[model samples]
Target: MKLLRRRGAVSLDDRLAALEEAADLADGRLEAAAVAGARAVVSRAGARRSLSVDHTVAALAGATGSGKSSLFNLLSGTALATVGVTRPTTSTAQAALWEGAGSGPLLDWLEIPNRHEVDGTAGGGPEGAEGMAGLVLLDLPDHDSIELAHRLEVDRLARLVDLLVWVLDPQKYADAAVHDRYLAPLARHRDVTVVVLNQIDRLSPEAAERCLADLRRLLDADGLTGVPVLGVSARTGAGVAELRALLESRVADRRSWADRLAADAGAAADLLARASAGAGAGDSGDRAGAPRAAEPVKAPETSADALAGPLTSALSQAAGVPLVVAAVAKAHRHRSVAATGWPVTRWIRRFRPDPLRRLRLGAASAPEGDAVGRTSIPAATTVQRSQTDTAVRDAAAAASAGLPEPWAAAVRHAARSRADELEDGLDRAVATTSLGASRRPVWWRVAGAAQWLVLAATAAGALWLLGLFAMDYLRLPEPPVPTAGEAPWPTVLLLGGVLTGIVLALLSRAVAWLGGRRRARKAARALRASVEQVARALVLEPVTEELSRHRRFTEAVSEARDEVRPGRG
Candidate 1:
């Protein structure tokens, strides 16, 4: 029996621990803590040794003057607990130990100092007989005592005892306070409770039988019908031996310990299951209604087009015609040269600007007197601060509208906050966008200047060489040497000037295109980050919070039940 009780207690503790862990995972921390506390209490109760005697340990509990003490003394063959006095006498718990192996540890754990070690007299018998071993009789204080300590002690010890012998005299057996406060609440523990009709000696046999039947009916009404009932008289010892024999049988079997622990665990499991079910119900709302698919709207695509158009237009205009056309023409020329032109020149031009550069329309001026016509050049529109801000705000609002109520509000707030951050990023992007603006690196400027100088020097050399070749080929007479102020315009020099202007235009366009792409990438990244933040705030966060709140409410309900009815079977 002792081994079984310990095992049962361990099993119950494990179940309680598992329940608490589940509660924690479900975000019911408060409930989990409560369950943990309950588990600890139960573990302590389980660890406390069971009565070791050969007889079954039973506690006789009742209201004041119910003759429970008198019945205890008559059964244990000693006047250990005070009786027969009108004054409330049993202040602390008292125990009567029949010859037993396990009674001492259990009594010590119960903190019952007063003990009567019975020998082979009264109900005591052979050390290992049905009536002798495993019995630890407890005379608990009146549960109805006005003294709070007495009631508390009685209630505290009630949970640990194996069998509760509720002794009630004929007069107060049907008392409302007793049945409502004690019996009805203990309905879950009915299997371990045995109601005894004490003081039946005062009634005639027929009256006693009728009273016993009425008591049984009351117990049934109290939801305790299945619990055994015995009519007895402490003064006459009527039915005492029968009760003793029943206790002996219970002790011999040793299954009641496990049964009691299982009952406790089962009750706890039921409560936990209900809580889990309630949590599931709360979560089920997600699947209850028709799935509300977000209606696809054409407006977002339109808005994207609207927003991108201005920026693209601005880029095209900033990159003028001389830059765009010249870069494309140069790339095409380079490709042709690489395929059919001299190998040495092809390698040299490999470092030259490609067609993609023309798309960029870089910030560079055309050569003087060689400028492309304004009509052929696309002009870039300067982006206004206010216009960009408005566009961003509108986009954020459009996304926020798709969210649920409270979440929608939170999304709006987040959008507004994030919009400010995005605007700051946009400002930085714009500031960094122009290659020739305040953000231009020193190396780029130096490189541009060096390239221009090299082109100028090359043009001068080409002109000089072309002039020499033309003079030699035409076999023209050396005309009179002209003064520096009188020098004629050389066709070769003009052609070289044109070529240098073309090279500069192409380089400018390539730079502009690269800048545009970089800005576009940055803008796209910022937009994506902002959208993700809004989604989390508006959808996921709200759902998680609601689920957590539901868990807490369920826990509160459980706590309320426990408070209203402590020491449940």
Candidate 2:
């Protein structure tokens, strides 16, 4: 109980729910048999819970000549089952219900047609029959009978019973067939099981004690340490009273079926855990198998953060981010030359194509929010495609490292599920990114306006000189030709304006070059960011989701298999 409270009071139903969830999440990633067994546990528990909540079903199971039928008749106070000593007696299961109320459905669920109803004061029965009003005792065929049908009947009923009373004789208590085929496989059901050394009257007291001690040793080795063991003689009515008290106590608890179902679910969950972490796929989950070194199943060491850097870098190269960045720098310079160059020489740079526009990734290509634009960037080359595949595979392998084979395969598959979309996604990301070239700088405008002013001054001075020449030729006096020192005003204006415009154009070009380099770096950062998004959506996210599923599945399995240690008997 302390363990239960410490673990947050996880009930048996919660454990079953956890196991069912794990089974759902790991349908194909776990062993087929193991998964099927878990489903069976859940289905059987639901059926049992719905059938008869008030009754406890305990089946008497033993090998041939173990006097199983005699004991069944003795406890039931009637010759309901035929008894035989040297041969098999009960070839089919027989049930004896107390009062027989609302038990038809329960019997039908157990598939038992031969049944009897016993009253509290009917015959010379075991005492306290009134207290066992909810008990349902079953007599099963010999598990070691020569007839295959009889053995099969015993095996089937044994699994469905709420409690099992295993009847062993002093002669064959250590029988290999019974121990290997039954007790060993049912080690997890210790809480819902009891052992009876039948036919003890035939042996001396010392011999019976020795056999009992030996049987306990065997039971403990089979992982049934806390289960009760009793020595009884049906013919002499030796320990039958004690067995009856056990039945009354179990029925009084009114939760034997619940305990049995919990054990079943726990066993099934353990099977799945072993299947997931076995030495190999399809390894046997049998508890009685030879001992081997235990293996701990740990979570994978890799995560998305560890894989994203290399993956995004490789994908960026594949998406042509470097080429696009270079084009952005050149396109900036080209546009800047037209906007800031001297008015007289601006046309010289017009013939060169805008690098960004040629790739359909210019500032004009990027659209408004949430809209993707098309691009004419060349398709990936063979080398680029190969590099992308290698990087993606490496990422998948690293993400799934240390997982079981099926889970690892699942992670790898998820990593590449979006491979067909990577090309288009990367292109859309590149074309839609804001690549720092949509508007010209304020400096470019100021330089261009200044250049135009200087050019206008130069043009006016030329016209003034032409007029002075014309006036002299026509014998008219020139209008007050002003001079600055040794040079005339028009001559000085013409030389200074032309030289100033040339110098301003050179200065503007130099500034644009430096600005273009800076813009290239910024554009590179933006383009890589876009490509990184593509990488996550296409590959990294899927891998991370799959790993999360694996973790959930394993955690559920652990919880489902965590049985309470104190009351396990």
- How far residue 510's Cα lies from its native spot in candidate 1, in Å, is 7.8
For residues 318-342, could you state the per-residue lDDT of candidate 1 as single tens digits? 3332343344344444444333332
Writing each residue's lDDT as its tens digit, candidate 2 over 52-132 gives: 878999999998789888898888888898887655677889898886699899999999999898877642443557867
lDDT of 1: 0.55
Query: Whole-model Cα lDDT per candidate?
Result: 0.55, 0.83
- Using TM-score, give the best candidate's number: 2
* Clash count for each candidate, listed in order shown: 16, 0
Alpha carbon lDDT at 402, candidate 2: 88
Q: What TM-score number comes out for model 2?
A: 0.90
lDDT of 2: 0.83
